[model samples]
Target chain A: MSARTLLRVLPPVVLLALLAYLPYLSFSVPGVLPGRVNGPGSMQLLATCLVFAGFALSYDVVFGRTGLLSFGHALFIAAGSYLLTVSLADWSMPLPLAVLVALGGTTLLALVVGAVALRVGGIAFAMVTLAFAQAASIIVLRDPAGVTGGEEGKALARDAVPELLVGVANAPYRYWLALGFLVVALVLVRLLVRSRAGHAMAAVRENESRAAVLGLSVYRVKLLALVVGSFLGGLGGVVHALVLGGSGPHLTTAEFTLSLLVMVVLGGAGSTWGAVVGGFLYHYADARLTEASGSGVLDALPGVLQSVLAQPLFVLGAFFVVVVYFAPSGLTGLGGRLVRKGVRT
Target chain B: MSDLVLVLVTGLGLGALYFLAASGLSLVYGLMGVLNFAHGSFMTAGAYAAWLTMDALPGSMAVGLRLLVAAVVAVLVGAAVGVLAEAVLIRPLYRHHIQQVLVTVGLSLASVAAVQGIWGSDPHPVAKPALLAGTVEVLGARLPVDRFLYLAVALALYGGLLALLERTRLGLVIRAGVENRTMVQALGIDVRRTFTVVFGLGGAVAALAGVLYSQYAGTVSPLQGGSLLIYAFIVVVIGGMGSLTGTAVAAMAVGLVQQLANYYAASGIGDLSVVLLLALVLLLRPSSLKGAAA
Candidate 1:
């Protein structure tokens, strides 16, 4: 490899190496993590963050790269999560078969929903996807025949799963699984974006009519992006279920999908690394902010102010608005600008 | 037969609430090309405003009088919020449709969370006038009096909106802008002001819907606006974006379908059927819903 290529790749490689070694570390981040880096609590949090990072990156494939503003990305994730548990607990499927069923079912769902939703372009497409997702959410919440466990959500069937993935002592294993999922997702997304289809998606995003005039099948390219993005998102959901031990009704809300949008935008859309960073930071902040809210510092504030700051979502949402106004390109874009400015100075 | 009457009247009432919510959404989307996610926040704010108003009033005050005052406060608050949001959050990012939508999304999340933080997530019982709380027999079916109030208020708003759109100078400009904003701008009209006005109007109507919805449910919660917003969104889409008449028609259909299905079939089936209706509408009559203006 050339010197420039080596320089470009070295930082991420080092970062990944450090992350992989995290479970062995004794370091604790006060106020940031609940325990030492190697402890179960911290490991589980990190694993959840990694899964969300992968999920946000998958969303970016459609939202940033392909310019499809879907409000129903949560549906596929929920499908993966609910399907995995159902297959294991109810259908009596083995671990391997259950995983396959979850992933395969999610992918097939994405294809079918995409094909139908893609028929209408722009905001209509968003609404259609949302409607489909809302339908799925209703079905899940209703828990037809009691398979989904309804509002309480279904727990992972321990007996149907492997032993290594079950207990708190095996958090590192789950963390590793989460890391592996992120790496796989990153590789797949990178591969997809580097392909001919990726270029077509970009063209379609820029101007569908012009792309079509240039002999590109706009519809097919969009469908491909949605399918790929959703498939990866489904993978994230599977990892999320494993790391968290179960999927809740929270996963099925439109708010979850919107949060993914916030993460992608916060990290800077259209860039894989930006999404990962955004997703990781968002999940980390969401988890830690609740802790911070109860800390002594917030107690010093006046009643109304303290109450307002107590909700992590309020802070994140306000920050998102500020970012939208000032940092339209997101944190990554802001960083790039700062770097460019430094060089100029 | 009595059950049918109750369901039908109740459906119309629900449809009225949906219309109140969807009308503003339709107008804003029609003229501004913004899907205001914060519209739900506006509803929540209005509901809380009314709740606070009623709570603050002296206990000696008549319940009916207190509610009337609360309704006015809610409407005014909703209008003010709508205008302020448009001027501050929306006007800055003119022409950037996605960013506009995203900002609204952020606003919705932040405001809703703030409300939740302050009030807690649980539903709070809303006080109602004895008249509104009572039931009226209609066609041998005892129906909640609030349902009729919903219908009356919705019809008044609908008629008021129609007159404003069809009769006034501002209405003409708004209508013209929705049809072709550039053309209206080319004619030396400041369409931006109309955007703000439309937003304020939409907000007021949405707030009114929120108040009425709270009355219907007999409770107010931070999440109340969100659940209702989904149906409102469906109504807007099914009716065709920006067409007030279409929104009203679609709202009633969705309401009736939801009520009838919930009653006839399973409980949650109504919600599912409404979605199925949206899908069918989009699939079968895609062109009809495309770029339709007020």
Candidate 2:
């Protein structure tokens, strides 16, 4: 590759490598870090972070690249989780087979949801997707038949997962699988965004009317993006189920959708690497913040102040508001600006 | 037959609550073009406001009279908060839909946290004023008087709103504003101030609904507003954006469907059916029920 191309690819390649080895690295040098870091626990955290990275990147393809703000994106993820878990729990399907079925089911669902949602653009499209998501979540919660496991959620059958990928002893194996999933997601999304179809998606995002005027099939480009995005999102959910051993109704909530949106937006929308970075940072901060809030660090503070600090959701909400207002482009955007300014100087 | 009547009445009661919650949302979206996600938080605030009012007042007053006082206080407080929210959070971000969505959703999250911090996570029981707590015989069927009261208020508000829009000058300005904000602004009216009033009115109306529903249900919870927000959005979606009559009609339809669905299906099916209805409507009419907002 040329110097320019190598430079462009270097950051994400490095990020992927770092994320893949984060758990082992953090565990090996435990005392070097300020906080407590149990070996297996850190491995699980890295695995969880990789799953969300995939999910956030999938969302960015549609929302950031295609300019489609869908509130029901979680529907695809939740569908994957439910489909995989149910197949594993009920039929004791092999893990790989279950993943394939889930990926297929979610892609088809994306087609149906996209067909309905893409009829209207902008805010209306968002509302429609949200409605669908709400309905889907309710169905999962109600579990009309015995399929979804209702509110309790279905778990992966012990026999379904390979013994090598099952317990705390298998944390490293799970981490590697999760890392593999993230790498696949990142590489595919990067390749897609650099292609002609990606250009068409960017065109639609920039100006749908103009794209239509230019004889480009705006709807088709959008639907294609949605399908790809949903497919990757479903893949992420499968990884989540694998890493966590189960999934719950909360995965389908509007809150979950909003959190994904926050991740993409915070990492810098429209940038593939931004999604990965944002996903990792957000998941890490969320896990750490939840821990910090309950820790003895806040005991000396006043009651109200301490309580506010203790509630991580409140902090996350405040962070979201601040990020949107001040740094609309997100951390990656900030980095880009700094780099450009440095070159100018 | 009696069971059907009871279900219908229950539907109407729920519809009234939906209407009260949705009317302001429709008004704000119509005039300002901002979907206030914090609209439910306003309702929650109103419920708390009512609770505060009731707790502060003397216990010797008649139950009906006390509730009346509480409702008035809640409306005033709700309107104040609405105006404050518009002026602070919403005013700066007008015409920026994505930012508006983010800020409002954030505001709602913060509001929920604040409420939890203040009231704790536990649901608080709000006793129905003794007078309306009892049931009255209507056509030889005993029904909670409060249900009729809720229905009556919703109808009265709906009628009053219709009259305001059709017969009053302010309504004419608002309608014109919705149709073409620039043209209305060219006519030299302070459209911005008008928006402030519409927002406050919406907030006040939502609060009133919150307070009334809380009393009827005999409970108030901080998280109740979050769920109600979805129902209100569905109502606004099914009812064409910027159409008051459409909002009223859609709200009632949703309320009735929810009640009937719950009666027939499993526990959570009522909510699902409402969502399915929204999706169905969006599919059938891509823009809205009446193709009002482009």
Candidate 3:
């Protein structure tokens, strides 16, 4: 290949090599967990976030590109998760099969949800999706006596072996797995957003009336957007179930719900990488805040707030207010501004 | 039959609470177009205030004194929130709807944290005044006197608000401002002052609801405001934002529907009935229910 072609493929080629060689260190190092580093709990959390990154990206596509606020994207995740679990339990399906089923199931679910949600544009979509999410969550929470394992959650019976996944069997391995999916998902999203579909979605979001007058099928475009969004959401669930080893109803925690929204807003909502980067920043900050509480330095924050400010939610709450009140463009937007100014100079 | 009646009364009482809680929210939406998610947080704040003051007061105070104390505390706190939020947070986003949404979301987050920090994440209980705590026989059934009291307080507040909106010069300015803010401002009237006044009034009403609900439930959870805000948004959309009568009517209907739903459907599907009703409403009369907001 020419030097130009070589340069284009070099980064991903290098990354592949690095991942292949990472297993060597796990065995060579004395204290490392034989083939990987990092514990299970965190591996699961990080993995879930990585999968959520795809969901967020799809959301950014619709929200930023189409001005369609869909709060029920959570339903897609739930649907995908349930499908994966059932496939594993009933069919003893391999992970790939499970993922395939989940993607198809979620895409179909997305079609249904989008059918109703897209019927009305703007705020109406948001309300409908929100209502759907609430109803779906309640259903999941209620089915505990049998299929769902209820509040307890169900785990996949099949084991994920090291040989099955480049011969590593821990969270660090799972983290790499998750990171791999996230990278691919991110690249795909970036490509899609640069395509004609992306332009059409943007056209509709910016001005539906104009797009309609131009003869673009607004409804069809919206359907495709939501379907893509749902597919990503399900794919995320597949990786989430694989890396985390378990799933449940409470997975729809308020913190996760609120934080996901905050992350999208914080990262400036539109860009693909913004979703991934925002996920990391938000989850990391939240984890750190919870751990750091009562450590005397920040203890004063909660202690002084008449003893009620000690919770990590307070920190999140404060962050929300500051950002909303002051930085409407979000951190990514600010970064974009700085970059623009620097280039101009 | 008795159980049905019980659910009906309970739902109506809770609906009044919801309506009262939503009053400030709708008003804020009307005057400023801000959703005021923090309206629920303000209710928690008022509840906390009432609890704090109750603890501070040693002897048993009269019912009137307690109500006065709670109302005053709510009004003062509400006014502070209104002014500070308007000046520092919301003022910058004036007429910019997107910024208004972002800032309000942030404000809600901040308020939740502030309250949690002050009260601890643990639930705080507010004691009902002894006079209001006991129940009375009404319509051949034993009823929680406080429920009727809330209903009474809500009606009184509504009456007073209607009078204020209709009879006073401030009211005329507000009405004129809501219909056409630019026209009033162009006529040399101070719109900023009007915005501030309406915001303060909205906050006060929300705080009052918070205090009343707290004493009635005898507990304040952090999620109190957050969850309440969700229902209020639905109710407002249903009732038509900025329509006082619409808010009251929608609030009661939702209250009854949800309460009855909770009574019959297993805890799992209890919330479903309301959602189903809302869905039906949306399907049939989407525009009429949500009014102009959607």
lDDT of 1 by residue, B1-294 (tens): 999999998899899999999999999998889998999999999999999999999989999999999999999999999999999999999989999989999999999999998999999999989999899887789998988998999899889999999999999999999888899999999999999999999999889889888988889999889888888889988999989999999999999999999999989999999998987887798887775878
lDDT of 2 by residue, B36-121 (tens): 87898899999989987887789887767777899999999999999998888888877788888878888887778777865787
lDDT of 1 at B34: 94
lDDT of 1 by residue, A145-203 (tens): 99988899999988887788889999999999999999999999898889999999999
Which is better, 1 or 3, measured by lDDT?
Answer: 1
Docking class of 3: acceptable
Query: Which runs in model 2 stand beyond 4 Å of their true positions?
Result: A26-38, B265-267, B287-294
Candidate 1: list runs displaced more than 4 Å.
Answer: none
- Model 2 CA lDDT for position A277: 79
Which CAPRI quality tier does the interface of model 2 achieve?
medium
Ranking by TM-score: 1, 2, 3
DockQ for each of the predicted structures, in order?
0.77, 0.59, 0.45
Query: Residue B176 error for model 1, in Å?
Result: 0.8
Count of backbone clashes, every candidate in sequence: 0, 0, 12
RMSD of each: 1.1, 2.4, 4.2
TM-score of the second chain in candidate 3? 0.92
